[model samples]
Target chain A: MSSKITWPVPDPAAPPEAHPALVSAALSAARAYGEARAEHTRGELAESSRTGADGTATMRVDELVEGAIADTARRHRVNLLSEEVGFVDNASALTMVVDPVDGSNNAASGVPLSCFAGVMVEDGVPTEALTCWLDTGRCWHAIVGEDTAYRTSGRTELDGAALGLLRPHPEIGRSWWHLAERAERVRVLGTTCLEAALVAEGSFDAFVDPGNDAHRIVDLAAALVMVPAAGGVVRDVFDRPLEIDTDLTRRWSGVVAATPELAERIIETVRG
Target chain B: MSSKITWPVPDPAAPPEAHPALVSAALSAARAYGEARAEHTRGELAESSRTGADGTATMRVDELVEGAIADTARRHRVNLLSEEVGFVDNASALTMVVDPVDGSNNAASGVPLSCFAGVMVEDGVPTEALTCWLDTGRCWHAIVGEDTAYRTSGRTELDGAALGLLRPHPEIGRSWWHLAERAERVRVLGTTCLEAALVAEGSFDAFVDPGNDAHRIVDLAAALVMVPAAGGVVRDVFDRPLEIDTDLTRRWSGVVAATPELAERIIETVRG
Candidate 1:
């Protein structure tokens, strides 16, 4: 399907305030891209006849989403690091690490927890992030200093905090162990991007996904911008500062999330 | 907060048609009742905090919800069976089992996965059921004669035919072994009642809650109506038909649900 969004040329002179807008635009573009990916995945699922042999394989949705992200970045002349196809368009100081679709496997299986996520960073500092649920048409955004947040229906606050976790892969034993110990009431909603957004809404105390499935940078780009802006925290599993750079592109399992206390505790639990 | 909803009234003498009005009324009433339960839960959590406990116990929500259900049912003159308290108004032909707050621990601990559920059974057969989410204000309903069904944000589908299951608890190796053997995608969303509603929506294949925590007849009532209406199936681990009776109260050891074939397979696998 055609999209109405036009890519604006990145002007180095442009004020940083436009960063969130850029992130939002990229997310909207990614939603269409994700839908196309879903359609392709639907066909693939039908052809595969329910054998999950392809579970670990790279998805067609990935390619479609990456293409969308790359096109948007190239038009805006911003650097991009996308999960599906990797890095591209490195002319501007501002960069975006995109997950064309988080929870691609769930999307392929017709689970409703899949989405498109894009995070923008300026000079290595996260400035904005956007996540869009492809099927539900719901979008969430976090922009530094702008104080903007959104939520879908059914959102609630308990103990004055909302925290969500994506599927805690078996590898994140520390995370689960910590949760079991704390038993502070949590949710594993199965979507990383959405979990991060939920953190932004203060609907959750934190959102933690420590699996090394992707580089910390990809998850961080979104978490860094959203968590802090929402008056929460984000950090690595070690409770150390998370810095963005080329090293993050490769897979490294670590905690990525909201609330420093939650992060530190998770790191300690996992380390033990 | 006081509510205007009249409860415990006689069933519509003319046999209420499946019109949107009846559904709306049921939903609104359920919502009001659910809120009362939630408020009580909040108080319980606070009490737990004062006692230096982490507030994971579901006892408070259970009592509050049961009370609300009774008051509401009394207004409607409907029969009721609740998880916390036992049967009330049992002489009525159409007995209503009300799981005042499904996923009580989750609700008590600030997790948004819990919900309020009820089912209307005539002569031991479910004729109608309603589920209301206290946090999100979303409601679902199912009526007899058409199999079970419900609504979610304008989406409608059958239960169990599209099943969802909680990952088997390690303690219960049999259930997971069974699910893996059948290649069923087992999930643990941590809320049995919500899982049951998804069965009505066909969003999941079935739902399994091995830790029967709040396994009261009232807890399964609404889901029972919806699942059957949607052409899905649910059963205890032994492959016995799921019944709404006092036996299920707080039994949390294991449970299984799915389409007839899948449910049967899961039962056999666990039985072995």
Candidate 2:
């Protein structure tokens, strides 16, 4: 099965340790889940009557995808840590951090800016990551040791930089807007994984969260691997390393940027 | 030519005076231009060496699209009011308010949330409007007397409504976040026409601007027609009517909502 999985190596120097078959299984599961759900209307899919394993309101689509992904992971003998089903312990050493659907509101509302992401972690470190955009069916992935498929824009200034921001809670809205006002363009696309990918691919110079524990481990898992692999910086708001335990309840306020300088500038702007 | 263009009657009551052929020609032009530009990368398309007709930095893709739109308007014998080329007088009663490439920054940076919008105004009142999502090629249109193709979500409360917000400047950032904090979700997709269309189609409950002169005639022209046709309310922040002159220099702070109740709630939230 490991031999059957083909991973593209953009950087020949860095090959990942997690078996490619595990990543392939996750991607195939996500694609299958997304395709099935795409046929339904937002109205049919958006009912939040049930609570997820993570304690947030769960939609029908969430349960559907989570079930499909968990089935795939079990078949591949990989452990799963996901939003809807919490952590499913398996026999293998590798754990897949997954968000069956990120930006549920956007997906439920037909906003076309949601995605499915899964990151393979081995021995407490993420080895490989994959993000599949649900609307466009475009997928981006990176292994920590491989050459990144994309590069950051190398933009160091905020004056005219394209920035992506997540929606802020009332307590942090002011702080969020302070940083937003300094940038030439600010977009809040309502999806963290896709927004982080935009920064990694240079579509956006940065993707910042106004200081609140708004993002969970599942949300930032793929970004933690993809951003650094693409020559971008992913850090917490306080300049702390953006590592968290595999606990589903743990949350982080993240800032993913094209460069370290831009990341520091964002930190200063929000703190100041 | 006018006889050849058949406008679909979503509303049997609305018999627009503007010829359907004019609207068809404009839509075709936008589609053609978008398809041509979609082949290039964001890096290749995002050069800002030349200034646009509106005194903002212009990209080569913008010029290409704007020229194509202008030529189409000229061929159709419609007067033009646009962001790129300003006003072009023609020997026709119908003036097409156009944003050749709305969300230019999004397009240039490959954000996939940009559009082309054209509204046919006779005697300063918008009669027919068309908005084409550039990335997806999905188009929404409405004539004043016709039945609307979509409806708003009719959510009156901000607590859990899907809100679309424009990025606010420093002067208005506080006011913007004040309203943003109350909403269940806030999205800043960076294109006025498409955002407004989302509101009109029930995908978003409301689309608001933080109190500043952020939007121009070209931005709101299509919304002014589409929102009302879809049974939504559009008004300025001051509770004034959202009517603007044909002058490209003029600007307004606007809000489009699924209901008058929601619009009033947003206005009160911002002002308070």
For candidate 2, the TM-score is 0.84
Model 1 TM-score on a 0 to 1 scale: 0.69
Error of 1 at B209 (Å): 2.4
Give the Å shift of residue A258 in candidate 2: 0.7
Indicate which candidate wins on DockQ: 2
Model 2, B1-272: lDDT tens digits are 00110111111111244356345544555555455455666665667677655657777667777777777778878888878688888888888888877888777676777787888888777888888776655678788988874777777887777889887677886778777767778888989888999888888889998788777878888898889887888888876556646556666788989889998899888888
Candidate 2 clashes between residue pairs 3 or more apart in a chain or in different chains: A11-A147, A14-A145, B11-B147, B14-B145, B14-B146
Best by TM-score: 2
Give residue B1's error in model 1 in angstroms. 25
| DockQ of model 2, rounded to 2 decimals | 0.30
- A95 in model 2: Cα distance from truth in Å? 3.4
